[model samples]
Each structure stands twice: as C-alpha cells, then as structure tokens.
Target: MGNDGQSVGDRRGGLAYYELEFADDGAVARDTGLRAAVTAGQVDDVFVFCHGWNNGADSARRLYTTMVDLLADGLARHTPDKGARTAVTGVFWPSLLFPEDDPTTGRPASAPRPTGGELAAGLEPAFPGNKDNLARIGVLLDDKGGSDRLAEFHERAKKLLTTPNLDAGEDSGERAAAELPTETVITYYSGWSRVDGQAAPGLADPVEGLWEGAREVLRTLSYYEMKNRAGQVGRGGLGPFLSTLATPDGCRPREHLLGHSFGARLVAYALSGLADGLVDGASPVKSLFLIQGAFSHFSFNDVLPFDPGRGGALSCYRNRVDGPLLSTFSAHDRAAGWWYPLASMLKRQDASSQADLLYRWGAMGADGYQVDTASRVRLAEEGFPYGFTTGGFYRLDANSVISTLQSPFSGAHSDICHPEVAWAAMAAADLAGEHQRPAR
Candidate 1:
C-alpha cells in the first residue's frame, strides 16, 4: 500500500527549507539536497522530526515549519552557544497510504473518508488549517448518526487488529516486531500522569461517551498503520538518511529527536533500530522528546519476565541515549485517553489495565511510562522540567506547562506551536546547556 512513484511531494513553505519522503517500499523518494549536504559535510547538526496521523507531505511541511520555529526559538534561549548549523529533516512514510496506488497512473484509488469531515471538528481544533473538519462536530456531539459511523470504523479496526499482516510490512525492524504482544492487549501508560487518578489500565473505558469510541477507532487504526510505517521508515529510509547526514568529517554534530503523536513512536522505534546496530554504523540519539505520543506506554517494559530477557524497543534505546527521554502528555488529548486504548485493545483482550508489571499496554502520552523498575523523574514536581539531570526517563503534564502558552480555551492537543511547549522540548532535548534563545 506504499507509494513507489518517482516524484516526491512539494517541500516548499517549511522552515527547514526542504523535505524528504519515504515510499511504502521503504525507499527515500529523493534527497539531492540532503545528499549534497551530507557529502559536503554542510549539515553540522541534525534535528529530525516525524508527524502524526492525517498528515500528508504538504501538511507535514506546515507542521514542521511551525514546530521548528518554536524549537529554534527555544534552542536560542537554552543554548546560546549552538556552535554550529543544524539540519532538520521531516520524515514521511506510507503509513497513511492505506490505499494502493496505481503504478502506471500514479494515482491512488481512494483516500480515507469519514462521515464527519474526518474528525477534525469533534476533537482538538485550535491548530491551524483543520477548521473545515469541524463543521458537523455539533451533530456528532449531539448523539445522532455520528456514533454509528464511528462504531463501524472501530469494528473494522478491531478486525484489522487481528489480522496477522497488519504490522507485517517489509523492512519492519526487529525492534518493531519485538514490541508486539503475543496477544492483543489494551492498557493505560499509568503513572502519576493519569488525569482520572487511576493507576490501573483496563478499568477505564475508552468509549465512555459519544464520539469517544468512534474517534478512538480511527485514531487507533491510523496509529497502528503509522507505527508500522515508522519502523519501516526508520529501518529503510530515516535511519540511513540520518547515517548519511551524520557522517563525520571535522566534528560530529549532536543529534536530537522530537516527535508529536505517532511521530513519537517513529522516533523511539528508529532509535531502537539504530542502537541494535540495525543501521550500519549509526550513532545514538542524544535526547528524545515525545510530545503526546500514540505508542504503547509499556513500550520500554519487559513483557516476558519469565524469560528474563524479553523486552521491547524502549529497553534497547534506553541505555544508548546520551540524554534522558523526555515524555510529555496532556490529559485533554481525547485521542490518547480514548483512541489509544481502543487501538491497543485489539492487541489486548478485554481492554484491561490489570497486569503483573510484566507487559504494560496503552499509549505513553496518555498513561505515562509504564516501566515500574526504570529510574524516573516526574516533571510536575519542583525544579523538575529544568532539573533534567542527564539520563533515564522523565514524564511531564502537558496541561501544566503547555497550557500557559496557548489561549486559555484551546484544546491542549492542537497547540504544539506554543513557545512554552518549545521551551519544554528544549529542556527535554537536553539543549538547555548554556543556550540563551528566547521563547518569543
């Protein structure tokens, strides 16, 4: 279902100036500029990005341009002595390419079509350019036809969840394969980060209200597909791309990864592959910043405890990272609270959070990190966000700090452009070492 066309999408408008995409076949479409940069050693620093669902190349451009603005602004404040230039790459994959495109005509047969403007309206809307999707949100909120459509989609996703081939895409890394549960399971990332004050996972119902269940269906399906694509992109394209750009000449620029939503999953899985030497001579990531991730919360936990060696990508990358993994979640993100559970439920039966501390299910951004034994710091505590003391893991409440930067009424999910979020990201990326860039 991936695109293998010779041409790539438009890359104009993004602040990074240019962008690159990966085909579903795991090949980077084109990277003349990026290749030149790497060959000439012009790209001294690397800052890579991955986008969430419902995003195309054009959309990714806008998303990264804005996100980079905040990140760059925050970097200026945090690291006054940046010392060198940076290359920001926006990674796109065939995760969203659910439909197979005709190789001859260069057109897909169809695109994702939801009854209610594809769900932009009912959930978070403050983010720019998604206003049209909200027109029928009122109808969905009022409890009418919307629920039925959403449920249908959820059923379809549930079926897809059971399909053995769902995550079986070629170029799927060992890290990706290792992350899957033997059977389906759903869990909350459960920690102090839970908004409902619940520690258990399965107790909470994902479809508690109207639109929640349906929205989750779409979200979960998209996430599963994208998560797989993330692995493929990492193994086939992004990883090699980084290796190329990261080629050492005079000095190696520090590397940082930042992802929003499923992009977070991509970044984590990519690092896992690189750490295991999956990519030929790839360097480790400095710091990881996961903003509202849609992947499993227990991704870092060892599920097969009896084996004593069974674990997922989190375990592989945890030790290799030079800086602490900074994970931030917002309670208001209906997608994580609802959709992530529904999606994970297909992998887990009964959608229960009850566990033996062996394998934790659910999204990291929603439930927080589930690895009980891992060293952790709660950013909500005093001197926390700024007190990132080098390594291990840290979880932050999105509403606590990210809210202050946006309009009071904006849904916390769509405000990634805020300077405060950027500030936190800077802290998470471990770029706060003598950086003095302003958040303005």
Candidate 2:
C-alpha cells in the first residue's frame, strides 16, 4: 500500500474478497470462500467493491480495507442504534497497470503521475515493464507509415468488437485479446496519428517534460482494458458469487456496490449482467455508490442512445434499487472530466463536436444525466458529501469539496476517501435499507 488515502482506525471487520482466477478463455476458474460462506449462511450485509484502473491486488485490498473501515465508522455515526454490520468483498480482476518501458537508459522510466502531496497517493509503483511495451508500440506506429495506421486500428478494433455481436458469430476469449493491446492502441491514437482535438494543456513533451503522455497512454490502456474486462466478468464470473449472495434465505444481508473510476464502470456492467435477478426483485444489491466515476453520466439514462441497444449497463439497475442509485461527482476531478470522454471519443471517432462529443465524453462528476426529473433533488446545503436521497437517481455534487474546498490544483482524481464522503455513503445505504424493511 504505497499511498493510502488517509490513515484510519484498524476496524476492518469481516473484510473478504473472492480472489479469482480467470481461465485463458476468461471463465471464472476458482472462487475461494465466497460461495462456501454464502452456502453456509455466514454472510450478512455484503458490500461488493470493485477498484478502478492502475491498481494491483495489494493496492485494491488496502483501499477496500480502508474504505470499509471508514464506512463502518460512518454507519455508527448515522445509525448507532441499528448496529448492522456489512461484509466487504473486493473483486480483483486482471486489470492492466500501464507500465511504460523507456528506451534511453534501457530501463523503465517512471511514468509521470499527479503528485499533489498525500491526496493523490495510489498503489502504482515505479515499474520498468510498461515502458518497454510502450516503446515497442511507438516503434510499430512509426513503422506503420502514416495516419492510415489509425484507420487500421479502427477497423481492427471495430471488427473484434462487432464480429460477435453485429455479425452473429461465436465471440471467444481469444477474440477479445486478438485486438491490439490497449497500450498499443493508445500510442497510435494519441501519439502521432490523431487529426482532431489536441491533448489537454500540459508539459509540451510527455517524455522530455512530465509523464503526462505516459499517464495519458496508461489511462487510455487501463480504461479500455477495465471496461472490456468488467463486461466479461460480470457476464460469466460473478454467477457463483452473486447467486449465493442473492439467495432467498431471508437472513441474507442487503448488498451495496461501490466502484471508483473504471471500477464504477465495472459495477455498472456487473449490474447489467445481473439485471435478470434484479428485475425480479431477487438481487442482492440494495444501492450503488459511484464516487468520482470515470464513466459516462448517460450510462443509466433511459433517454440516451445506448451502445448495446438494450440500454446502458445501469439501465436495468434503475428499476431494482431500493433507495437511489447514488453517485458522488466532483467537478474538480480533472482526470474524469478530461480523460474519460476524451479517450472514449478518440476510440470511436465516428462523431464530430456537434454530433455528440459531450455525450461521448460523459463524466458523472462533470455533467449529471438529463433523463429523469426524479433525479432533480434539491442540492445539499452542506459541503463535501452532500446528500440527496431522491429514492431514484441521486447525484451528490461534491464540486466544493474537490475544487475550492479540499483538493489542490492538479485535481483530485483518486483522492476520494474523506470522512464526510464516507458518512454520505453510509447515509445513503441506511436510507436504502429503510426502504427494504417493513413500513415503520
């Protein structure tokens, strides 16, 4: 745990995760204690957590432990009499950590990352592997001749994605990986081939000046990998785990999902996969808490044109929630605002500015969805984790906390572990729980 958000009390209780092994074919091979615990009925309230991009297993553990501990503290503060405990489960998948192998000194140069003191601390270490891969990518693109390389990539990715869905063929695990590694795609897209919008303001040369280029490259790669993997695991892997968690055993604890960054997208996809049970009121998830999510705000909006046509990942989730699909959005999350839609837009460069660029680069923190008037709850008068339990879609505007209040200029992309934010999360969960119990 290199950079934990804040030092909290060691009250991480019943914190466990389904450490998984996905077959080369992307099937869930092993689910350790999760199924056994649920089978034996030892589980209670479950808080299934998914981490965002650039995090290894250890980092994910440390973060989940810290968040669960703070959430417990917040629960006590909000509902001291209830005394209900939650089981925290961290789901770890083979999410890529963009390691840039540098060529000059024949060692991996540490990529540039945001360093605004303790707030921006994460689990990424100085790795030498990604630099080499990144360099290879650079050389390949240079060898590809011209901007036609981008077109090649576009066709390659499009074919890989659309073959199974659009053309009605068998899409296998190999097909997903058949496309270029997201790392290569990033080098080609943002490196020298793009003919559209420029990179955000930064040091001119990512290599010579700062690691912004490296960061962007990693961001691009991590985003694509996580989004793709989220869909994969959600569809196949969580069956054993979710089936038991959502049992009809009566004593099964209510479940809550909290995903940060790309993990936010993971939870959404998982919900989409689990929507069958959710639609029947048999789902274990009670509420979803998205914090500084690095996904589209239109992900759950019914009015928006969905990529898959069956509605966005969270589309089916809206009908299942007990209280609200809670999201804590911060305009000061510069990465979410700039990187998210921008990276996605570059990948699907089929649209122009007037077409749907804003929709394409949607960040829940920057722009809230425009689908439901029920989402229009009154703004919280307090600061940080402002509350708006509208019983449907509740987006907490934490702009004051992230921008002028707490975070520094570089922005607070991953610095979302404040006490008040935890309190808000538990408060929302508590409200959701109330909706489940008999009328008081």
Question: Which candidate should be chosen as best, given TM-score against the real structure?
Answer: 2
- Which pairs clash in the backbone of model 2? 99-130, 99-131, 100-130, 100-131, 101-130, 101-131, 101-132, 341-361
Model 2 spans > 4 angstroms off: 1-26, 29-32, 80-84, 100-222, 246-251, 275-277, 305-313, 347-356, 374-391, 403-410, 431-440
Each candidate: RMSD to true structure? 11.2, 8.7
Q: What does candidate 1's lDDT look like per residue over 1-440, in tens digits?
A: 11232222223222233356767545778553554554455554556777766434666667777866666665555564552355566666544422111122233335332344434342222222324333443244334444454434334333333212212121122122124431211122211122222233323643333343343333444345556666556655565555444444534445677777767777776664452442212354666778777666766665523234555545545654566567776667655655345334333432245352212345666656666544444444212346454455667666665432221111344445566656655665555563322220
Total residue pair clashes for candidate 1:
19
Q: 214, model 2: CA deviation in Å? A: 11
Whole-model Cα lDDT per candidate? 0.49, 0.50
TM-score of each: 0.62, 0.66
TM-score of candidate 2 relative to the true fold: 0.66
lDDT of 2 at 166: 13
